[model samples]
Target: MNRFTTMRILRNIVLLLTVLTNIGCDQISKDMVRKHISYYEHISVVRHHFTLTNVENTGAFLSLGNEWPSPVREILLVVLPIIALIAGLAVILFKQGLSALFRLGASCVIGGGIGNIIDRAVRGSVTDFLHLKFGIFQTGIFNLADVSIMVGTFLVMYSFYKDRNPSPKLPA
Candidate 1:
């Protein structure tokens, strides 16, 4: 194998491992929460501001589509995400010339997305428990998958920010 080919293979392996690690973390955390927290139960993990609450979400982010009709909800929440995730995975794997940061972000996004999809497909809902409130700023109850998604989003955005400004051009 040529040096270039070998490096390509190594990069692919690293990306796969990163994705699997993210997914594993998400699934394990959810499993732990499922085993310990009863339905609709609340546990204060960090005083009043930060609490753990068990709740199942059957809708899109922040329960936006929770009230949608069943058929619509299924197509929008489940089918669309599966399709998008597949497309994203293809881009991450096959798309070349991407920076390492971009790959990391894509992997996290895909891993987290798949984790939630597994729950929705098998349990008919996504398990969410972590809750946070800081005065006027409050986050909807979320899970590890949510955190992964957010971190991935930030990484992706950061990559863009860094790439947008190539070092200031100086006159030759």
Candidate 2:
């Protein structure tokens, strides 16, 4: 195969791998939480720092806007991810000037979003286990998919920052 063909094939494979890895990690962590922890039960892994607390979030991040009716919630949670995935794929295909870091970040975000959407569609909730706490401060329970999304977002932000033009030099 020609070099271009080979590179295209490799990129496709990498994208597939990223999606599969995100899905697999999310599913496996959920399974582990289901098997090991009863719902609402908290097991402290570190004193006032971290814990495994099983939770099922029916709405989006930190259970925000959860008061919506079931139908609306499902549509918002599941349909939005599908739309985002399509848009992300389009950006990957057409945004030739996008850096590799941006592409990777987009892939990761899409993959994680799809994974959570799958859980919400099939189970009516997203499984969450990791919990963080310090002094009087605490973070909501999250899962592997959430971690992937956060990391992807950070990378995307970093890429954008790096690509920004430096301030024009004042005649020195």
Candidate 3:
């Protein structure tokens, strides 16, 4: 095979592996949570700081806009993910020569989005388990897919920051 063909094959393989790994992680974590924890039950893992709790979220983060009618909820929860996945795939395919960090970030976002989309489509809800609490403040319950997306977002932000301000060098 020509060099271009070989490189393309390698890139595809890498992307596939990245996607599979993310999806697998999300699924396994959700499975474990479902098996071990009861819904709405909280198990403190770290002394009022962190907990493993089971929550089925029918809507998006923090259960936002959940009071909508059933059809609207389904469209917002299910159809939107499908659209985002398609858009993300298009960007991944058409955008070329992106920095390595940006590519990694895009892969992660796509992977996590696909994972959650699968859950929402098949289960009618997203399984969230992790819970963090400190003092009187508490963050929303989230799952592995959420973690992946958050990391991807940070990576994208970092890449943009680096691009805008390339590192300065010391005098030799």
Candidate 4:
């Protein structure tokens, strides 16, 4: 294969690996939580700073649309995200001329998105169980999928910032 072909193949492999790894991590942890934790019961992980509390969220982030009428919530939470995740995967897999960081970020986002989408499709809700608080900085219970999203968001943001303000290359 030519140099260009080899590089493209490598990129594809790397992207696929990143995507699968994140998805696997999220799904496995969620499965463990589902099997072990009981609803509304929590075990403190850090002496009041962090805990695991089983919750099945039928809505979006922080249970945003949970109170909405069923049909509306279903369409908004289930159908729309499926469409969005498909579009995102298309971008990550098909779009060319993207940087390594861009592909990594996109893969991470898409991976976690698919993991949660699977839960919503099969279970009718997403599982969440990690809670944290540092003094007054509290957070809604979340899972590895949420953490993946946050990491992916930061990576994407960093990619944009770096692209906009690239550093000068030193001479050899």
* Candidate with better lDDT, 1 vs 3: 1
| Counted clashes in each candidate structure | 0, 0, 0, 0
**Candidate 4 lDDT, 96-155, residue by residue in tens:** 877778878888888888888888888989999999999979999898988988899889
Q: Distance (Å) between predicted and true CA of 48, model 1? A: 1.5
TM-score of 2: 0.89
Off by over 4 Å in 1: 168-172
Worst 10 residues of 4 by lDDT: 91-100
Global lDDT scores for all candidate models: 0.88, 0.84, 0.84, 0.88
RMSD of each: 1.8, 3.0, 1.8, 1.5
Off by over 4 Å in 3: 169-172
Of 3 and 4, which scores higher on lDDT? 4
Selected candidate, larger TM-score, 2 vs 4 = 4
| Tens-digit lDDT string for candidate 3 (17-79) | 877789999999999999989999989899969999998988888988567788898787788
Q: In lDDT terms, how accurate is model 2?
A: 0.84
Q: How accurate is candidate 1 locally (lDDT)?
A: 0.88
The candidate with the higher lDDT, 1 or 2, is: 1
15-112, model 1: which lDDT tens digit per residue?
Answer: 88877888899889989989999988989877879999889999868888889998988888789999999999888888888888988998888889
lDDT (C-alpha) at residue 10 in model 3? 81
Candidate number with the higher lDDT (2 or 3): 2
